[model samples]
Target: MHNDTGELVAALDIGGTKIAGALVDGAGRLLARARRATPADGDAATVMGAVAEVLGELLADGRRPRVRAVGIGSAGPVNAAEGTVSPVNVPGWRGFPLVAEVGRLTAGLPVVLVGDGVAMTAAEHWQGAARGRANALCLVVSTGVGGGLVLSGRLHPGPTGNAGHIGHISVDLDGDLCPCGARGCVERIASGPNIARRALETGWRPGPDGDASAAAVAAAARAGDRAALASFARAAQALAAGIAATATLVEIEVAVIGGGVAGAGEVLFAPLRERLRDYATLSFASGVEVLPARLGSDAGLVGAAAAAADACGLWETAGPGGRRH
Candidate 1:
C-alpha cells in the first residue's frame, strides 16, 4: 500500500434508495463524504443525475484534492468484463453501462466496477469488521439482501461480478417469490422492506407515517412485541440457512452482518446463529462465526475506494469483491 502515496480516490456507493459519495484515501479512510436521497420513482437518469450532482459537490469543495481513480459498487448482476451493473431495486438500471458512464463522469479516470454487497465486503475486509480475517462473508440486509465474500485473502467477483450474492440463494423451492423470479430467496424473506411487510402482515402496524422500516420492527421487538419478534426470528432463520449453505460449500470463516436490517443487532443475529447451527448439514459449516459489521454506514464508500485503489495498484491488498482469504 506504500505506493499509494495516500492519494484520494473517489468512492461511490449506489444503493437502491440512496447515493453516497466520498473521497477516500488509499487505506479506505474517507477524507470527505456526502449523501443524497434517491428519488422514490428510481429512474436511472434521475439516479445518475443525483450521482453527478454529488460528485460535483465533492469536487466543488475547496478541500477536494487530486484524485487517483474512481470505484463504484452498485446493486447488480454486473457484467464484470464490461464494468456494467444492473441493480434490481433501481429498476432504471438493468444492463446499465455503469462503469463506462461513471468513467465519463470522472473524465476517463480509471474505474473499478463492483456489486454493492461485494463492495461492502471489500471495505469490511480492507479496514472494517473482517479486517485481519483471511476468509469471511459480508452480508448487507437493507432495502434488499446482498453479500460478497473474501476467501483465503482474495476478492472473488465470480465470472460476472455477482459472486457472493447470497440473497438470491433459494432456500425453499416452494417459498416466497423473489423479484429475480426465484423461490424463497433470502432477500425476499429477510430484506428491510420485506421484514416490514412481514410485520404489517403480523398485525404490528407502524403508525401511518409509512415509516414502517426494519428499524421500526427492531424497536418493537425490543419492546417485547410478539409479532415483530416472530418476524425477525423467521428472517434470521432464513438468512442463516443461506449463510450456512455458503460456508458449507466455500468454508467461509466468518459472516459479518451489516446494513439497516443488521442494525437490529442481536435481534437479527442471535437467532440467525441458532438457526445455522440447527440446519447446517456439514460439520465445518457449523463453526462459521457471525459478527456485526464494524464500518458503520461508510463501508460501501470505503470499500469502493479500496477496490479502485487496489485495482490501480495503489494498494496490494485485494478487496471483498473477490475470494474470501
Candidate 2:
C-alpha cells in the first residue's frame, strides 16, 4: 500500500457543515482538494448538488484519469450494505442513495460508502493515533458525538457501518432524553452543546461577547469557574462511562478523542482520565489508554481515501467489511 502506483482515490467527506473532496495518493497525501458549505436545510437534490460541485472540482484536475475509485465518508447512520445514508443533521436526506448518486456523477467509478466515524477510525488506524493498535475506539465529540472502532488490527464498521456509535448508548438510566429518543445517552450528556447548556443551567455566565459555547465554558473552567468545572466534570463522567463500557465489551486498547470539544485540552482530558479510572476498573479494560487524535480536521478525507484504497484492493489487509456499489 505504501508504493506509488500512480493510482489515486477520490475522497469525499460529507458533513452537516461542509462537503469536502480530495484526491489522495496511496501514501495518504492529499493532492487536490475542494470544499463547499453544506446546504443543510435544502432539499436532497440541493445537497447532492453541492457534492457534485466538489467532485467537479476534483475531476477538473489534469490528474483525474489517475483516480481509480471514489470513497465517501458521510454522517451517519449510514447503511453500507445498501449504499444509503440518513445523516441526522442533514434533514433533506433520509435513506438517500448517496453511493448511486456519486457513481452517476463519477461516471460509474467504483464507490465505497462509510459512516464518518468509521472513516475517522480508518484514518487513525491507517496513519494516526490508532496505527498499529490491534483494538481501539476513536471518538468525535462536537455539537454531536460519534465514534468508530478498530478491532483485531482492522476497521470494524459492522453491517450498517456504525458499530462504534457510542453517543447514543445510555450511560445513565434516568438522565436527559436524547434527540434519538433515548434516555441518558452519552451524547445527551457530553456533546458540546449539552456541556454549554449544563453550564448555563448551573449559573455559569458568558463573557461580554455572549459566547456561551462549550469552548467558552472550557475557558471558564480553566479560570476556576465552579459551575463550568462541574458541567465538564459531568460530561467527563458520562464519556468515561461510555468509553469504559465499550472497552469492557470489546477489549479495546486505546480511545482516541477528536473534534472541536477535544480541543479544550486538559480541561476535558484531565477530568475524563480521572473519571475513567472509576469506571474502567476491570483488569482487561483498566489499561486502556486515552489520547487525542493526531490527524485533526483532515481525518475524514484521509480515512475516506483509505476506505477507497481498501475497496480498490490496494491494501495488503482487508478494510472494514463492505462492498463497492
Candidate 3:
C-alpha cells in the first residue's frame, strides 16, 4: 500500500526487551504503532515470531497509512552490508538475516537497517534536541551504553554500521575488562547495570523491596547515600571523558543523552557536566553542549522512521507541510 501523494514508512525498533513497530508519516509523526515483549532467551525463530506479531498488528491497524518503505533499528552489532545482526543482549539471534526477513514480511518493500544508536541519532537530527545542529552525538545509557554520530549534517554508519560505538571505546587504557573484550570501555564503567553493580559491591544494600537497579541507586543517592553517590560520580566521570574524547576527535556542537541512567536527571548530569570541563579542555571541545534527549521514549520509533524516510528520498519534501530537516 504505497501512497504516492501521502507517503508513509513502516518503522521497527527492535531491542532485547521489546519489539516496537509504527507507521510514520512523511513529517516524522507516528500515525499508528504496535509493540511486543522480545523473547530474548528463546530460539531465533521464536524471537522473530514476536517481531512478526508486532508487524502484524501494525499492518492490521485501522488507520492504514500507505507504507512506502521499511526501516529497522535493531540492537547491534549489526552488519548493514550483509543485512545481518548479532546483538549481544539477544544471544539467540547470532548473525540473523534481519533485513531479508523484514523485507519478505513487508511484501518486498525497500528496507534500511541501522544500529539502534544510529537510529536514535537520525531521530534527534531530524526532530529532537539535535535538530539544527550540524554535528552531534546521541547516547543511550541503559543496560548498555551505545551512541551514534551525525557528522557534517548526516548520519555516519561507517562500514560495519557500528561507527559511533562509544560504549566500547576504551577510555581507561588500564581499566577493567569489558565483555566486549576491551579494557576500561565506557559501557563497562558507566552502564546502569555497572553502576548498580559497583554500588552493591561497595557495601550498598537494597531496601526492604531488595531492588538493586540503577534507578534504586539513584534514589539512594538522592537520599544521601554516600556509596550510591560515588557510583554515579564514577559513571559520570567515565561518560564525560568519553564525550570529551568524541568532541575532541570530531568537532560536534552537542551531545544528547537518554536511556535509564539519564533518567537520574542531575544526579548523573550534574557531575557529568562538571567533569566534562576537566576532560574537554581543548578549545574545539570546550563549547559542546550536553542536553537531555527531547524525544524521550519515542526516539527509537521516530528515528527508525527518520531512517526510512531518508532512504525513501523524502527528507527534502516530507515536512509538516513545513518542518525543517
Candidate 4:
C-alpha cells in the first residue's frame, strides 16, 4: 500500500438479511466493523441510512486510520456504470444511486459498486480459497444461492452486473417455481427457503424458538434427524447439478462454496460430489473441483475494499518506483 502506513477505506456488504460495514486499509485489512438487521428497516433510504450509521461509527472512532473512500458490495441487479442497484431480494430498493449516497457521507470521496457475489469472489481470490487461481467460481448458498466468476485471473461481473447467476439455471422443467417466476431453478430446490420447504413437507418442525435456517437444519441432520438429512441430500443433488453445468459452460478449474447453508460440512459436500459424479457427461466437466470458502465473514469486507481501492486508483498511492507506495 503506502509504505507502513496505508490509506484507509470504508467497506459495506449490503445483503438481503443484513448490512455489514468495515473500515479497511489499502492492504485489505479490516480496521473496524459493525452490522445491523436489514429487515428491520424497510426502504432503500433506510438501508442506506443503516450503512451510513456504520460508516459514521467507524469515523467517530478517532483511533482509526484516515479513511478515504467507501465501497459497497450490494445484492444484484446493479448498474455499475450508473452506480444504481435494484436487488430482487430487496424490493424496497429500486435503482438507488449508490455512489451518490455514499459519496455524500464521505464528502464526495469516490464510491465503488459491485455485486455481493462478485465481491465474495474478489475477497476469496485475493486472500482466501480462490487465491492464485485464474478461473474459478464462488457460490453462496444462504437466503438464496448466488454465484460469481473469476476468469483469466480477473473478476467478470458482466455488463449489467448480474452474470454468473448459477442458481437460476434450471435442472428440472417440472421443479418448483422460483421467486423470479421461473420454473425448475436450482435455487428453488436447494436454497435455504426450499430446504426448509422440503423439511416441512416431510413433517420436520423448525422449532418455535429457531428459524428454519440452513444452519439449524444441518445441526439437526448431524444429530441423526431424518427429514433434515433428506433435505440436505436434495439440496446437495441440486448443488452438484448446478456445479456441473457451470463447470461445463465456463470450464472453471475449481468452485468455492460458502454461506450459512454450507455449514452442513461433508454432510452437504460429500453427497454433492457424489451427485456431481453421477451427472458429469464428459471428462472436461468431470475435472472441476469443489471446495469450501475460507474467508468466512471477511470475504465481503476485503472485496468491498478491493472495489474501492480499484476505483480510487489513489488507494495505494503511486510510489517513486512502480511498486505500491
* lDDT for each residue of candidate 3 in 149-236, tens digit (9 for 90 to 100): 8887777777767778899988899999999998999999999999999999998899999999999999999999999999999999
Cα error, residue 12 of model 2, in Å, equals 0.6
- Against the true structure, candidate 1 reaches a TM-score of 0.89
**Model 2 local distance difference test score:** 0.90
The candidate scoring highest on lDDT is 2
Instruction: Flag the better candidate by lDDT, 2 or 3.
Output: 2
Q: Show model 2 residue runs off by greater than 4 Å.
A: 316-325
Across 159-254, the per-residue lDDT of candidate 1 in tens digits comes to 767789999999888998888898999999999988889988989978567578889999889898999999999899889888988998899989
What is the Cα-based lDDT of residue 269 in candidate 2? Answer: 96
User: By the TM-score metric, which is better: model 3 or model 4?
Assistant: 3
lDDT of model 1 at residue 281?
Answer: 59
Candidate 3 global TM-score: 0.94
User: Could you tell me the lDDT of residue 26 within candidate 2?
Assistant: 77
Error of 4 at 123 (Å): 0.9
Residue 15 of model 3: what lDDT? 94
Q: Name the 10 consecutive residues with the lowest summed lDDT in model 3.
A: 316-325
Which candidate leads the pack in TM-score? Answer: 2
